[model samples]
Target chain A: MDTRERLIESTRELLWERGYVGTSPKAIQARSGAGQGSMYHHFHGKPDLALAAISRSAEELRDRAEAAFTSSGTVSERVAAYLRREREALKGCPVGRLTQDPDVMADPDLRAPIEETFAWLTGRLAGLLAEGRTSGELHAGLDPAATATALVAVLQGGYVLARAAGSAEVYAQAVDGALGLLACHARQEPSRPA
Target chain B: MDTRERLIESTRELLWERGYVGTSPKAIQARSGAGQGSMYHHFHGKPDLALAAISRSAEELRDRAEAAFTSSGTVSERVAAYLRREREALKGCPVGRLTQDPDVMADPDLRAPIEETFAWLTGRLAGLLAEGRTSGELHAGLDPAATATALVAVLQGGYVLARAAGSAEVYAQAVDGALGLLACHARQEPSRPA
Candidate 1:
């Protein structure tokens, strides 16, 4: 890969591991094997490179979620599949973890991708849920928009709990709980006419 | 406040604002208005001071939640009240924020308070939910342990969404959605005899 690609990839890894505040330009250079000159040649500085990295991560997150949402399944099954997707639970989310970084959140330019990513995710999920309701698969009482937000939050919060306990099991339990609650909203099918 | 008290408070504020990686001894000392000699005299180092601050924050979180849980009302009412409690949503939860700090999570001593706080919170919430089930206030099908984990996760994840969007409304929506889903589990009262 070229120096620019290497730098972006390295920044993404470092940002995931150490966050923005703890990740330094020097470390990024070392990780990517790109000198100061090459880094400057590719991007203006840490902020510029971080923006690229963050944007890439956000796009990837959206792509992954889209795949999960669009996969062949009922709404409940798809939602369950998304929650149960394999993740580096102990490492936390690449994009979600950035929300905790003060430097990242304080800058409007840096914060935009994170904001857009979540908005897109929740909106997509809400659309899928509304589809489910229209198909009579989900109870009519289930509020699509609100339920979408809650579902996303549960996955995000599950990471926080898993990291706190240093155990992936906590994350699994949280997802299971969310799934069980959602199961309560499943519409019972009427018997077919003879 | 005494010197030690001031130092802990300052550390708490800094930790919340900047996280462990960004929080430095010099910054803490400056914020607390305690000199180098005074700081060293009072505590071992940054880690020592951070532990004290984290423990204090954890204790306060538990105390606040306990008050919310014990308030006079049904289980659903108490849960709703807890979710609806006033908060600096954009600023995020003091204890939950630390889970994203690599430095804090890397060390057992620093991570202990965070682990204990969530455990205590989930345990307490589960107990309340179980009581609700026993009283027939909640559906018998409800799983207390998993529901408690999901509830706590929604709150933690709600902060993530709010911070990402730079809006407290997102957080409120997430909480509202969780509450709505939870309401599905509320048992109905039996009809009164004439």
Candidate 2:
């Protein structure tokens, strides 16, 4: 990859691994194999480079979610697929992890992508749930938007729980619990054989 | 407060505001008015001091949660009360935030309290849920352990979302969503009038 791409990729990895406050420009230079002059020539400073990296991570997160949302299946099934998708639970989320970084959260430019990414995710899930309701896949009592937010929260929170325990099992159990609760809202198929 | 207490309290605050890597011993001294010698006398160093602070935070977190779990109400009502409890959403959870800190997670000593606190919380919630099942207040199909894990995850994730958005409303909405899902599992009383 080119220096610019390499810098952004390295920044993304560093940001994910060490967070904003923990990640330094010198570290980024070391990881990317780019000198101080090259780093400054490519971007204004840490925040500017970080913004580019964050935006990239946000877009990738959305794309990954979209793949699950658009995949062939019932709404509930698709949601399940998204939740059950393989992940590095111990490593935490690339975009979601940024929320814990005080430096990232304090700056509007650094915070925007994280905020927008979640908004888009919750919005997308809500739309899928609304579709489920329309197609009689989910019960009428289900609130699409609220349920969507809860699901997203479960995924994000699952990372925290798993990381805390140093076990991915905690994350899987959390997802199972969410799926079970969601199943409680699924409409029973009248024609299906017992 | 005494020098030791002040040091612990200040460390707690700094750990909450800025993570482990960001919180320096010098900053802790500055915040607590404890000199280097006093700090060293009280604890070995940064990691040692952080352990005490983290343990204190963990205990307080459990205490706060216990209040909700033990509140006088039906199972669903108590759960709702817990979800609706007021909080400093932007600040995030004291224990949960530590999961994001590399230094905290890297050291088993620092990670112990966080892991145990969440384990205790989930276990407590699971016990409450099982009680609900025994009383027939909730459906038999609900898995108490998994559901409890999800509930805790929702809370942790809610903080992440709210902090990212720079709005507590996001946290409130996520809680509302979880509550809505939970209400679906409540057993209907045939004798009660609508």
Candidate 3:
């Protein structure tokens, strides 16, 4: 890969581990095997490099989220596909991880892509829930918007719980609990015959 | 406070913002306003100071959590109260924030106190849920342990979502979504047993 590709790739890795505050231009240079002039020549500075890296990461996350949303399945099936999608549970979400970065958390320019990605993900999820409701797979009373937000929160929070506990098992259990609760809202048939 | 107290307090504040990876002994000395000799005289190194700081933050979080649990209210009431507990939102959870700290996440010593704090919190929340179940205030089917973990996860993830969005409003929406879902389990017994 070229210098720009190498730089963004290394940054995604560094940001995942060191966070925005901890990851520096020097660190990126070292990781990318690129010199000072090479880094600055390719990008203005840290913020510029970070903005590119974040946008790349956001695109990757969006692609994965879209795959989950568009995969062949019922709405409930698709939702489960998204939740049950294989993940490095302990490592957690790379883009979501950026949210905890003090520098990223502070800078609006740096934070926007991460924010928009989640907003779109949850919005798409709400749409999926709408599909479920229309198909009579879910109860009408269930709030799609609220359920979508809770779904994302549970997964994000699951990572915190799992990491703090030093196991991915806890994260899985939490996700399962949320899904189980959602299952209760699956259309409960009354005595009426169609 | 004395030099030692100053050092610990500074470490706590620095750790919350910059995290263990970004925080250095030199930085600690500067922030604490304690000279090298005084800092060394008070503590051995960063590890020593970090342990003290993590433990202190853990105790404070627990005390704060207990206040919400012990407040006069039903289970849902108590849970909502706990969810509504005033938070900086942007600064994030002092203890939960550590999970993202590379240095703290790397060293078992620093991670231990954070782990134990969340463990204690989830356990206390489980007890509250169990109490609610027995008192007919909560759904008997709800798993207290899992629910407790999910509740804590919502708060942690809410901070992440909100911060990423650069708005506490999204965080509040996510929490409201989770709380509203849980509220569905609140007892809805009809009056007049004719």
Error of 3 at A85 (Å): 1.3
Winner of 1 and 2 under DockQ: 2
At residue B86, candidate 2 shows an lDDT of: 88
Per-residue accuracy of model 1 over A63-123 as CA lDDT, tens digit each: 8898889889999989988889888989999999999999999999999999999999999
Clashing pairs in 1: none
How do all models score by TM-score? Answer: 0.96, 0.96, 0.91
Q: Is candidate 1 or candidate 3 better by lDDT?
A: 1
Please give the range of 10 consecutive residues that has the lowest summed lDDT in model 3 chain A: A185-194
Taken over the whole model, the C-alpha lDDT of each candidate is 0.92, 0.91, 0.83
**Native RMSD of candidate 2 (Å):** 2.6
Where does candidate 3 stray beyond 4 Å?
Answer: A134-136, A189-194, B187-194
True contacts kept of each: 0.73, 0.73, 0.51
Q: Candidate 1: where is the Cα deviation over 4 Å?
A: A189-194, B189-194
For B1-194, candidate 3 gives per-residue lDDT tens digits of 99899999999999888878778999999998999999988888999999999999999999999999999978888888999888988777888878987778888988898889888998999899889889998767777787787778888888888777777877777777677667655567312111
Docking class of 2: medium
TM-score of model 2 (CA atoms): 0.96
Q: Which is the winner by TM-score between candidate 1 and candidate 3?
A: 1
Tens-digit lDDT track of model 2 for A1-194: 99999999999999988999999999999999999999999999999999999999999899999999999999998999999999899999999989999999989999999999999999999999999989999887788888898899999999999999999999999999898888878888322111
